[model samples]
Target: MNKQEIGTFLLRVMLGFTFLMHGLSKFQGGLGNISGWFQSIGIPGFMAYVVGTIELVGGIALIFGLGTRIISVLLIFIMAGAILYVKLPAGFMGNGEGTGFELDLVLMIIALHLGLNGSSFLSIDSKLPNRKRGQVSDKMAS
Candidate 1:
C-alpha cells in the first residue's frame, strides 16, 4: 500500500478499537450502571442499550473496513451527541465537574474525515467487486 493508504488503515483500525473498547466496557462493567448514568444525564436509560449496540457493531465494521464511511457517519453522530449533551457543560478542563468535549470533538472530526475520504484499499470494502476504497456502491465514478 502507499503512504496515504497505510495512514488510512491505521486510522481506521485505531478508531475502530477505540469505539469497540468503549462499547465492550459498558457490557463488561455493567450496562445497568451505564443506563443509570444516562438517565441521570437526562438521556433515556434505554438509549444506553442502543448506543452500546451501535458502538460495538460499528466498531467491528470499521475494523474490518466493511462499511467504514457508513459506520463513521454513525459514530460521528454519536460523538456529536456526546459533545452537545454530555461534555459541553464540563468545559475544556472538566472544571472539576466532568470531562469536556475535547476528546469527543476529536473523535467526531476523525469520523467525519473517514466518512468523506473513506478507508484504504486494505479494507474489505475495497475487495468487493465494483466498489472502491470504502464505498458501498459503484453507481458513479470515484
Candidate 2:
C-alpha cells in the first residue's frame, strides 16, 4: 500500500481500538459511575445508558469497518456532548487539571476524519457487494 493508504489504515486501527476500549469499560461499572457523575453535573442519568450503548455499538462498527461513516457521525455527536456537558464546566482542564478536553478533542478529530475519509480500502466496507446494479464492472467481478 502507498503512504496515504497506510496512514489511513493506521488511523482506523487506532481509533477503532481506542473507541472499543472506552465502550467495553462502560459495561464494567464504568457506565454507572459515569452516569452518576453526569447526574451530579445536572445531566440526566438515563443519558448515560444512551451514551454507553452508542459507544459500544459504534466502536464495534468502526473496528469492523461496517457503516463507518454513520458510526463516526454518531461518535462525533457523543464526543461533542461529552465536551459540552462534562469538559466545558471543568474549563477544559478536565475536572481539575489543565483543560481535561484531551480525550474529547482527540475523539472528535478522529471521528471527523472517519466521517470525511470513511473506511480505508482494506476495510470490509470496501469488499462488500455493491447495492447498485452495473456498478461493479466485469473485470472487477472477476
Candidate 3:
C-alpha cells in the first residue's frame, strides 16, 4: 500500500481500538456507573444507554471497516453529545482533578475526520462495487 493508504489504515485502527475499549468498559459496570453520573448531571438515564450502545456497535463497525462512513458519522454525533452534555461544563482542563474534555475532544476530531474521508484502501466499502463502477449507460458513442 502507498503511504496515504498506510496512514489511513493506522488512523482507523487506533481510533477503532480506542473506541472499542471504551465501549467494552461500559458493559462491565463502567457505563452503568457513568449512566448514574449522567443522571446526576441531569441527563436522562435511558439516553446514556442509547449512547453507550451506539458507541459499542459503531466502534466495532469502524474496526471492521463495515459501513464505515455511516458508523463514523454516528460516532461523530455521539462524541459531540458527550462533549456538550458532560465535558463542556467541566471545562477543557477538567474540574481541576485531571478528569477533562481532552479525550472526548480528540475522539470527536477523529470521528469527524472519518466521517469526511471515510474508510480508506482496506475498507469493505472500497472493495464493494459502486454505482459508477457497476452501471453502464446505453447512450454511449463507443
- Which candidate ranks first by lDDT, i.e. highest? 1
> Of models 1 and 3, which has the larger TM-score?
1
State the lDDT of candidate 3 residue by residue for 14-128, as single tens digits: 7888777777777776777878987997888777687777777777777778777777778888778778877787788798754678888888787777778876677777777
Off by over 4 Å in 3: 30-32, 132-142
TM-score for predicted model 1 compared with the true structure: 0.86
TM per candidate: 0.86, 0.79, 0.80
Worst 10 residues of 2 by lDDT: 90-99
Residue 71 displacement (Å), model 1: 0.6
Indicate the worst ten consecutive residues by lDDT in candidate 1. Answer: 130-139
Q: How do the residues 1-142 of candidate 1 rate in per-residue lDDT, one tens digit apiece? A: 6898888888888899999988998889788999999999899999899889878888888999998999999999899889888888888658687887888888888889899999866789988776457775645654
Pairs that collide, model 3: 26-31
Q: Which window of ten consecutive residues has the lowest lDDT sum in model 3?
A: 133-142
User: How accurate locally, in lDDT, is each candidate?
Assistant: 0.87, 0.79, 0.77
Error of 3 at 89 (Å): 2.7
